[model samples]
Target: MTIHSISARRANRSAEARVADQGWRELASELNNHGCAVMEKLLSPEECAGIAALYPHEEHFRSHVHMARHGFGKGEYRYFRYPLPDLIGALRTALYPRLAEVANDWNERLGLAQRYPADHAAFLKQCHDNGQTRPTPLLLQYGPGDFNCLHQDLYGDLAFPLQVAILLSEPGRDFTGGEFVLTEQRPRMQSRAEVVPLTQGDAVVFAVHNRPVQGTKGHYRVNLRHGVSRLRSGMRHTVGIIFHDAK
Candidate 1:
């Protein structure tokens, strides 16, 4: 099917059904209460299989392996560097439309269209203002035994708080080692962290910065320092979608 068809189908999904399927309201409530929210089983098994099939293990091993700091200790971890093939196919065909819908929905929720219109306009203008620049999609893959360091997704002045990951592997079957962890606060006395063990078709939504609330002083903050734990079992696979350039 065409990308347009996929997007139309995704969009035609009733809001109530989407909420029921993804627990979107609960997630939104969690985000309101905290800085992040996790929704389980956001995608179907068939969709997960389709995404997984897009990335062959042999091909991934040949092209996307790399080393990065896995934890605070001396040792490093193996990571799949780029899984763009499947992601590109998904983006051009399926992901963007869903992402756009999410973006629009979130924009409405946060009233970002009114608050950050100038910033958004300026950013988009800057992207288009430059003659040689063309907006590009970023795709990063992770596999078993691989891990990423705790860091924010910020590059220069162009940064966005929202990000999405499409899970491609089965929870217990594919690989069991990589778990996405997020720190709630950093360098604070009462700081805490949470490890989100997500299954196929699940996604995590989080804020990159804290918005000030009336009663609390920095009580609700966005701690975007996130990383993955080492993969120990079967190989884990995921495709990340980001709007800004990966530096």
Candidate 2:
């Protein structure tokens, strides 16, 4: 076989690997019903540990944020710089098109005109053109008594509808009392909260700001915010993949 043929076959396999996963259809259905879906063991324990280990390396990140200083809660997080780590960059590229399909569907249901492009690079170009050039992927760390405030991940005008967070530390072994929490605010109704269960290497994809919810009359938009409950003991680590760039 020619070298070009082998390369083409490899590329096709990569593309197929991204979208042909068994769980994607189920994930979409769950997102349509609930504003969030969990992808269990998206990474292996070794991969999770490798990512969490990057948290202490200053060269990998662009900026560090102290949550208390910004009134964002108690923990700390660091935004990754450009040229993301290979696994993260690959995951970001692989996951976007799948989520974009669901995002476009939600936009149509909510009567919004915006549509996401099928690929991550094109969507990123759109963000960069609008002056949002900073990468949004981040590593977050939490210790005893630490927590994150409920907030949307919107960084600018061109926010992607969905974002993902992967738990890098084992819950029962590495932490306790720190739970992933999400809240939904419906019009003329009380806010509802959801506690997402995650283990090491597990990921949860959820609304970044708003999502369409079905009602008696038609689909309505519901505001969403996610955070972490206070940690009572030990430590925890997580990685966030936000498709849109920050200004």
Candidate 3:
């Protein structure tokens, strides 16, 4: 789609529309069965390219992290500054309410008392009130030999439970073998690993730390972590939309 059309779509809240078309029932089912769900082509190639291009411009980001330097992994990423780009801001707002529904259900099933608000702005205000005022959305870049370590994206005590990452570069064409990976650690059971498939513009909405799993006895909390596998060749870029802020 052209930049003009993309702008028109965002202006008309197309993010919400497309997400609705994905069917909240089915999306929640997928999230409950697995720990993640893919929203196909949530962004256009042009839009992905535009966001990826912003990585080199430091003005758009507040902090840069070399993963290896922190013993996290081999890749690097930049945290977006306040006043996020138009598309990022729009998607964050549009996606939250739908995900919040699933999050609330999960919280109840897990016996957690925390409940998310119906609106993204209200939830964000709660985060800020708890001293998590810094933005958590980030852009990640990886090349050959680069990979992200298995970890959770918890920034503060006020975590939103779910987060999203949109692939900005095409597999095979733009890069290869840098797959999205998730691991589930259940009580007294063997851990399971899943490699999520994605193409350019695809977004995966996933659990950040914990999710409830149904057992014969009852619902139990399972630990979850996500990361990227090693890149074989070329380059990769992704934009992550994490709802909660950091200190």
Candidate 4:
């Protein structure tokens, strides 16, 4: 099988099983080692479908011009904001609670949860003391022939080091060309990037910044630079969740 196939297979496994199967620990170790890690199928198929159902296709999704030069280019790209109520409304009462639970569990495992209750308390307290607040989630939709640039999602003073995306389109079905690429290895200027083509019901998690070295006041974070390969045909829909301090 191809590397992508292997990665996809690894990602498609059960989250709990993956965690127990050494992959989760390996992923966490990689994040600790390289400042980033990419995991697939962070969400269940049912949950992914529920999220897609709530995605508003008719509502206007603002084109992200802020990083157009980076590779976003100019075509059809839209953004959607999500509030807690909206999430509950979209996913329905029955599913919202479970989804929230899953989100919290994921956050805790990824070390993004508030620290006071955990080992990262000092860091969490520092962020709160520094005026960082929670950030809202958003949905990104790319239409046929659309694309986006590679840039970071830096908002406010909150130190949001993780970002996630839920795939709503089926590969080779609802879309054919949009692929998520990340700079892997090489010099900063000539870094080799990896493309992660996802299918419906797939979820990806990645770190937004690098951990700080010793003596640093804060972690050295980079904007999680990412973008879609041109969508040759069909539409691509994704739900992005960015966790941050409440403003």
Candidate 5:
């Protein structure tokens, strides 16, 4: 990339962070009400493509997963290394405080004793203290006939309640039928399936494990798992920002 391109990307990211700052309240409201929220066009198309391009470079990743080998699904993904990409790191930093506030509120409602720190660094320090030193940010790639199994992104003992996944490939043009799928399981009710709509540069923020729901007597916990439907054609790529580190 040229210096001008790099500068443009930085400006784009700055603008994106501003958007997150302004929209966080609405986003939190959606999370409290629906357990998920979509932030549209958080990244520019060039930025998205830039991120996806990084996936092929082995030095940027600490580990790779063939989802089928682990029964995770049919696609593949790679966990980022110690030094995350500039864009990813900025996103993790910019978005954490807002999500932390939502997470703290949920903890109170659910009667959970643990409260998260206000910033990502402190929370990460806590994770590292608990021996969760592996970075969990990842890039996932899906091809035709590939899919992801429904699952939570919780890494270790300490997990952030919310996580974000940004679509790096155009839905209709770059891939087909690989929709973002989320499932919610209430205590005594049948699971509800939600298909999230996302285009290139869009991001979906959701509960990483469980969310609190209002019940007749009190707040109850509902489990959530997210995945992708099988792609009918072409290739897809996504950037997952999992706040917690792995063991």
Candidate 6:
């Protein structure tokens, strides 16, 4: 790509981000009340397709995992290499600061010792210093009957509390039956299941491992795991943004 092209794209992304930033306060409120929150059409359809099209490009990814082989489910995904795509990287950079505040608040509420840095770059540097240098952002693809198992994206010693997944394909048109699923486990309580609604270019910000929940006594920790249901028809593609790195 030409230097001018790159510069223009960056400018465009910055402009769009200014708009997204307006929703942060509301998003934070929703996340605190619910374990997850859906942001509508965070990316344009063309941008969504641009990301999905990268799934088959071997040069962009460092590693691929077959979910069935690892008992993770029936689909597959590939982790981005050191240099993520422009859009993916931009999304990560734009989303992190807002999320860090919520994460830190959760940490305080749960009395956790670790605190997130003010920005994504600083947090990533900490990960790198700890020998967790692998990029964790990934592209997932699923076809008929394919699904993802419930799990957290805790790759290394360090883990960010929040992560996001953007749906690249339109539901009902590009695929059906597969829904974003989040399960929360509360102490001595039955697991609660939530199927998040999403559309193409839409994204859901959710807890990576755990979140704080209010109880009669006080705030307590509740474990969270995310996955996808079976795809009844067509194919599905999603972009997962994980702020932390892997060992």
TM-score of 3: 0.95
- As a whole number from 0 to 100, the lDDT of residue 96 in candidate 3 is 94
TM-score of each: 0.62, 0.93, 0.95, 0.58, 0.94, 0.95
Residue-by-residue lDDT tens digits, candidate 5, 168-235? 99988998999999999998889999999999999999999999999999998999999999999999
In model 3, what is the error at residue 122, expressed in angstroms? Answer: 0.5
- The TM-score measured for candidate 5 stands at 0.94
Order by TM-score, highest first: 3, 6, 5, 2, 1, 4
TM-score of model 2 relative to the true fold?
A: 0.93
Residue-level lDDT of model 4, residues 125-188, one tens digit each, is 5556777534335556677767776656666665455556668778887878888776533224
Candidate 2 vs candidate 6: which has greater TM-score? 6
Model 2 ranges with Cα > 4 A deviation: 1-19
For 149-210, candidate 6 gives per-residue lDDT tens digits of 99999998899999999999999899989999999998898999999989998899999998
Off by over 4 Å in 4: 1-23, 32-38, 57-134, 184-189, 211-224, 245-247
What is the Å distance of residue 136 in model 6 from its true position? Answer: 0.4
- Tell me the tens digit of each residue's lDDT in model 3 across 67-135: 999998999999999888878887898899999999999999988898999999999999999999999
Query: How far is 57's C-alpha from truth in model 4 (Å)?
Result: 7.5
Worst 10 residues of 3 by lDDT: 4-13
lDDT of candidates 1 onward, in order: 0.51, 0.91, 0.93, 0.52, 0.91, 0.90
Query: Any residue pairs clashing in model 6, and if so which?
Result: none
lDDT ranking, high to low? 3, 2, 5, 6, 4, 1
Instruction: State the lDDT of candidate 2 residue by residue for 1-247, as single tens digits.
Output: 9975565555456545744664888999988887899988787898889989999899999999999999999999999998787778778888898899999999999999999999999999999999999999999999999999999999999999999999999988999989999999999999999999999988999999988888999999999999999999999999999999999
Best by lDDT: 3
Question: How close to the true structure is residue 182 of candidate 3, measured as C-alpha lDDT?
Answer: 96
Please list the residue runs of candidate 3 whose C-alpha ends up more than 4 Å from where it truly belongs after superposition. Answer: 1-12
lDDT of 4 at 186: 23
What's the alpha carbon RMSD for model 3? 2.8
- Give me the displacement of residue 149 in model 6, in angstroms: 0.7
